[model samples]
Target chain A: MGELLRPEEWTALRLSLLVATTATAASLVPGIAVAYLLARGRFWGKALLDTLVHLPLILPPVVTGYLLLIWLGRRGPVGSFLADQFGIVLSFRWTGAALACAIMGFPLLVRAIRLSIEAVDGKLEEAAGTLGASRAWVFAAVTLPLILPGIIAGMILSFAKAMGEFGATITFVSNIPGETQTLPSAIYTFTQVPGGEAGAMRLTIVSVLVSMAALVASELLARGIARRLAA
Target chain B: MKEGLTVDLDHRQGSFRLQAAFDAPPGVTALFGRSGSGKTTLANIVAGLVRPDRGRVSVGGTLLIDTNSGVALPRHRRRIGYVFQEARLFPHLSVRQNLLFGRWFAPRAEAGAEFGSILDLLGLGQLLARRPAGLSGGEKQRVAIGRALLAKPRLLLMDEPLASLDEARKAEILPFLERLRDDTRVPIVYVSHSLPEVVRLADTVVVLDEGRVTAAGAAGEILSRLDLFALSGPREAGAVLAARVLRHDPAFGLTTLGTPAGEIHVPQTTVAVGSTLRVQVHARDVMVSLTRPDRVSALNILAGTVAEIGNTLAGESSLTVRLDCSGAPLLARLTRKSVAELGLSVGMPIFAVVKSVAFETSHRPPAVREG
Candidate 1:
């Protein structure tokens, strides 16, 4: 299998896994927090926050990538500060691919979690409060556990989306083999060159298999959680 | 009242207004009312789940909320345990874990209610390893109760905990509740609409009508008021008597009760001899006789003088007659036509014929004998 495809293809697959895992991990807490706010918070600008969270889903991926580039580019406000103060570079790198993927997949992550939070009975939280749980304690003990399946599903969706991310990632960080070139970018690169049909087809098969595995894992995790809750 | 709970609050939500003030004398004060009368709202105010627009609430002399002074404790800090109508158990938690959830949050100074004894009390010994979803309705309520009690709360508030259960399930949990009241020292505020629940459980009764407390006093005194039931519902108004079990006539499946008035024969009860049972004699079930009528199917009869004949209550065709049999107070709901035909006056002699089966359900140990 290692000899069948070039090491560059293997590098792309590994980079894709790293970018997707990093994106899912980095955004998980913030995703859950935003979802909780959307589901339960009644503060001012709630609608605006909700819309902001969902903007990446509604906007074109290229447009979102362009906006991220403008805001996080070397000469941009946040980018210059990070470059000068922390000496960390994101432009035209694998980390840039992860950032683009995270932003694009965030909306799906938040939506699933938000729906689960909304489905939770407020009465149980109230009951927990009466049992002497503080607000934070109640959320940690009751709300968090009850929304585990939703969080898992959201993470899987984000991971899968990050694994296959193309337009946003390519726009933000150009496809560089072994760097920013993820599974989709590798497949796209292979299809563009001559006699690259076999390579493209091989990468496409791996992508499909990866997505199927993710879907199976999500189903199994959700069912296990549901069974535990029911038991 | 003793070292119990006191609440005086006024709150208005849209068109509804709640003006309630009552001293709950410790052992299971039942907040009695119809669905819309704000019984749950009042209970919520006490538990600090709902902030009263203006009022003071204190338990065991500790002021939980005093809107006038701007002294308010959050529900969690108030050390209150509320058992909701629904069990509200954590679906993800095992029965043992759910019971221990409150134990985790209990104050450091608070002594934990021993888990073993509480599990034993609620009959949850076999259920510790099981999850809440696997429990029956009655078993869930029992676990809910254990969860609340394990908090070692200063005050326990039950908001119609049995309301969501069927009659059989309600019956199953009621004995555990009675045992909870009898064995536990936690002061309880029990909110319920069912008359039998109040009669069987409450020491103090607070009657609510349209968001206002209409009457508040000892359970026996408040519950016996014919006028009080006219507003809540007249179908349940009656005399609440404390009668001791003299002996059981097992051959006929009957038990004889020795009341302050006379010997009363009731249908079989499982209570042992000498236990003081609360007997709720429904006013409608008591037939009045001017003379000693013989061969009546009703097995219990007590001769007494008419204490007071209430005027015809509004929207009801019947007048309530109060019978004073020695020191015991019995109520009889007679129509105006019967009042006139029997020539029943405040001082007239009468025979109160009580249907024996009425006592079948009336023989539970209510908290307060005087109430």
Candidate 2:
């Protein structure tokens, strides 16, 4: 493993994994809540909320990143408030890159989970409720188990998107080596100079291996859950 | 202890409106109606799934809902078990897991101490490890029933649990349902469009039609009244006799049933001897005579006194006459001309001749009798 890539390349690879995992884990609960609301809730402003959730998907990634920077930058409104109140920072840091990746992947996560929630039979939830399960318990037991496959699919999709999230991440947090620089940033840096083809190719191969492993893991998990759920 | 149910509710969805009120005093009180007659809506209201516009629902005098004072309880806290038309067993759970899903919520004092007996009662002992997807329709319904029973509910609401099954599957599950009704001793509100199911399972019957309650009374009395049958089944007005199988004549393929009316024989049934069941005698199949016809070809003759005469509308030739055969109610559809020729009066003694094969009787399986 040491001979395959230098120290900088390894840091970029590890940083990319860290960013993607954080983004995926951070968005899971809110993503599911929004997806269920869109699928089953009847309320005002639902259409606007839906469109806003999908804005990252349809909008250019740079614009999403720019908007995020405008609102969450050090001098920006939320950024300044968070910095003063909590002594935390996100701009130009790895955390900002993770935020950008999460925003970029959120639409995929919400869409996948929403589709599964729609496919689930609401009557089953009602059955659990009548069987003495509270509303929260019903969701945890019946709704969560039934939608396990969809949640896994969403996670895989979001992870893939986060892994390749170049435009938003780069715009929000510039290519700072050993700081915000992830695999994509490192590969771009390698390709910008002469005699850098080998390094760039190596990192690209690493990216492919990471994504393929995630895909295969998702497949196995989905099949195992399906088998357990069926006879 | 058998806790009775009382409900008086009014609700409307779109253009459909429902107004119903009835009392269910233990055993199975069937909501007998046709497909769109609002039986399911009433059940949903009682179970807290549907909120009625105005109503009062109480189980064993404990108020569950009272729109007058906003005393409605949520569905999860109602402690009422429901077996839907389709067995909505959780696909992700094993049979044992499904059975215990609601058992956790029951109070500690009632948390299914009879769990092993219930599994035996539903024949689910061997299926504990299996999931629901591969089970047959009958097996799935049995599991559903067992799951609801394990909840230790004060009352059970079954909305045609056998409606989705085929005839053979219905026959397969009917005996188990009978056993559940008997052994569990839970007051059940059974909803169905099938008349035979009502006669076989219902102790008290509440008849609904076009979103209105036409009548509610003891099952035998409500069923014997021709006017009540006209609400849903106009032509099936008959008597429901509580009979027990005495013996079987295997040589002639016949079974002897001892009813309060007299000894009656019918086509051989698979039900075991000494099993008690309701036997339905159709009005169209009866031929009444003033004196005993010695040379009649009919195999059964019941001695009775004409108790009541149905109203004969102008220009209508046929009317119904009810007979009290030793306290057993029997209905006979006779022509106005026949009544006038024989001078049939309320006290006149008559003989009701019915062919043995015309008895539309219920055939319970053998397993339901002794166990």
Candidate 3:
């Protein structure tokens, strides 16, 4: 494993890990909030919100990346406002890659979490409220713990999706050697050259191993949560 | 008007409409009804979980809801503890955490021996560390009760806390409930479809039928009303009497109870002397006779005057006769044939025979003064 990976391959692998981690961590809170809202909120425009969240999954990956670029580009309306207000830029940067990955993986994250939140017994939350817990307290103390498995599942799904993201990441934040290039982008770059089969094969193997490790870790976490809930 | 509960509410859910208003004295006030009879809905309104379309609910002078003033308290702010039928304990938390979940939100001033006494009273001291998944139905309910009590609620609402348990589990929890009502002095509004449970626990009984209050009074008076027997199935017709333990006869394995009417001997009970016990004698288990019969195996024979005679309803084979045994109320279910043969009528003297060991007893702990 050590000898076959060149320095550039190592960079891609490390970059992939960093981008996936950032994407997963950044989306965690918003995903949970959206999931809970979708699961429990009874309001107008709920269906529209649901459709918007799931649009990335139904649209082509390139189309999603293009949409993100149109809205979040340096000269774009949102992009210029964000850059002027917060001095933050996303276009052609590793953060853009993470953003691309996050948008691409959001549907899976929210879907898993929403299902789990829906599965939680609302009656238990009512019981908590009657016990003198306010609405926020009920959510934190009762609903959060009950939906931990869903959160874990959502995080893992988003992480795996972010790691494997290629089309959206390349379109939104083009592949840069040590910056925006994730594992799939790096493998695609290697496959384009004549003598790059071996490198591509090695990176492909690393990608598979990382994805497997993520899935196994998620399984362990979900199982642990289930055991605790059952206990 | 005094220290009690007053509820006047009107609500509509789909096709069914509920309009009820009553004042319950401080004690265990039972909301008695069958399924879809709006008993649970009434309990939820009292707890501030369900809002009525128009009404005012006040417990011990604290206004929970007054639609006239547009004042409605949220459930958490109501400070009324509710024990649900399913217990509804948090599956993710241990029993200890579940019990303390309410304490964290309860006002500190209301906190005192409520926590320790509830833990002790419900016998939840041992299973604190166990998760709710590991608890039996009865144990979970006990924990649920403890959790509610620790909230230091002024009024406790129990929505059929034992309806989900089997007979054995219910038997296991009933005594704890009796002790809770007697010891805590927290006015409890218990919702139950089972007449036996109502008779066993409630000091005041409010009978509901089709989303209306058909009867409301003391348990003894409500249970003795033969007119309400048609509402609650005839099998549930019975009389509840307040009696004190007279003596425990070790020789014949009998315990004598002294009611206002007469002395009743039953299979020996472990209750201590001089403790007040509510005894429920089902009307069906009682036999009516004109003259005092000799050589009868039944241990209870009370001389009484027929207070009221209810005619047989359509398609009914039996008639209900309300008897006033001295000062205590007794109910006897006699067949139409027997009623005619014995010539039973209002104000006529009669003898009611009850089989020993047929009475259900609810033992109350000696009342403790509340601050």
Candidate 4:
């Protein structure tokens, strides 16, 4: 496998792994919180919150990427605030690509988790309440364990989405070799140049392998959780 | 009213209205009613799962809810344990973990029973390592009960915990419940629609109809009320008597129970002598005769005056007759033809004959205590 790939292909493979892991990990807590809120909370503007969380899935990937660039660019309000306060910059960086992937993957993660949360029995929470468990404890002791499979499924889906992300990463962070360049961006770069087909094929094979591995891992993780819960 | 659970509440949702006021004594107080009678709703209100628009709820002496003062204790802070109809055990946790789930929240000082003893009492020793999904219906309910009991709740509310089980399953859990009732001092508010369950388990029965509490009193008094049958179905019409186990006749496989009405004999029971038990004789099983019949196969006979007579209830052809048997109330159900043939009416002298096999001896120890 090592003898078949050039250094640049290897770099893109490593960068894609890093970006997908970071995106999946970074969106986990917020994804779960938003999913729970959407599934159980009855506050005002619930529908609006739901719509916003799901917007990335409905909108075209380029549109989502462009929107992120406009809001998170160095001169944008949020970008300017972060750069001035923390001396941090995201534009044209690997972190910016990861950010773009995370944003694009958020909807799938939240949807999977939200559906599972909704499927949970509310009576168990009530029973826990009567048994002296506070709402937080009830969620931790009962709700969390019951929804573990969903959370794992969501994370894997988001990771795969992040791995395959092209339009969003290119539009938000632009293709830059060894910096903002990811697997998809590098593959696209290879396709545009003369005599780059071999490199693109090698990188594409790596992408397919990584995605399959993720899918297998997800299947095992979900089955393990179900077995533990059923035990 | 001095102690126990007192709930007087009014709640309205859409078109349904629940306005119930009842003072339930400790021990086991059953919320008895047919389906949609609001008994479960009342139990939920007491458990703090449902907040009433107007009312106050107090268990023992603790003020759980007072809408008048805008004071309401949250469900967890109220220290109330609720065993739902479906058990609702944590499927992801082992039975032991489920049992210990509530102990994490209750203060150490409030943890009353030893965990081992609770497991023993509920017969859950062999199931400690198992999960909820693997448990039978009866086992799940027992685990649910153990989970609640381990919580050290100030009050235990059971909302027809056995309603989902078949008869065999229900019978399997009843003995454990009886042990819990007799051994623990925790006040239990049992919600059930089955009359036999109410009679066997509840020391005090609160009858609900529609959304109103139609009757509330000692189980014996309420079960013997002839008029209440109009709401509690005529077939369920019966009398509960506090009886003392006299002795067991091993040779005949029978046990003798002494009640205020008279000495009654039943099939052999394991209950020790001198232990008090509640005996339920269904009204339909009681035969009424104008004159004392000689050479009758029935073993028990009580002479009493017909205190009241009601017309056929719930379209049943049988007329319910309330009798005062030496200060004890007894209900007798007779067909309209038999009532007319005997020319029976209020204040008429009647002999209520009961077969020994017809009575159900509720083995629950009469450990009546205030909540």
lDDT of 3 at A178: 94
| Docking level of model 4 | high
Q: Each predicted complex: what DockQ? A: 0.84, 0.83, 0.84, 0.82
In candidate 2, stretches whose alpha carbon ends up further than 4 angstroms from where it belongs are: B1-3, B111-113, B231-235, B244-257, B266-275, B308-320, B333-348, B360-363, B367-371
For each candidate, give the TM-score of chain B: 0.93, 0.89, 0.95, 0.95
Residue-wise C-alpha lDDT for candidate 4, range B179-199, written one tens digit per residue: 899999999999998888888
Displacement of residue A97 (Cα, Å) in model 1 is 1.3
What DockQ does predicted model 3 obtain?
0.84
**Each model's C-alpha lDDT?**
0.87, 0.89, 0.89, 0.88
Model 3 chain B: ten consecutive residues of lowest lDDT: B362-371
Tell me the tens digit of each residue's lDDT in model 2 across B188-262.
899998887888889999999888899999998888986765554546778899999999999999999999999
Q: What order do candidates take by DockQ, descending? A: 1, 3, 2, 4
Give lDDT tens digits, candidate 1, residues B184-295.
Answer: 9898888898888888888888889999888888887887776776654667778888788899998998989898879998887888899776888888888999887898
Across all candidates, what is each one's fraction of true contacts kept? 0.93, 0.82, 0.92, 0.90
Clashing pairs in 2: none
| DockQ, cand. 4 | 0.82
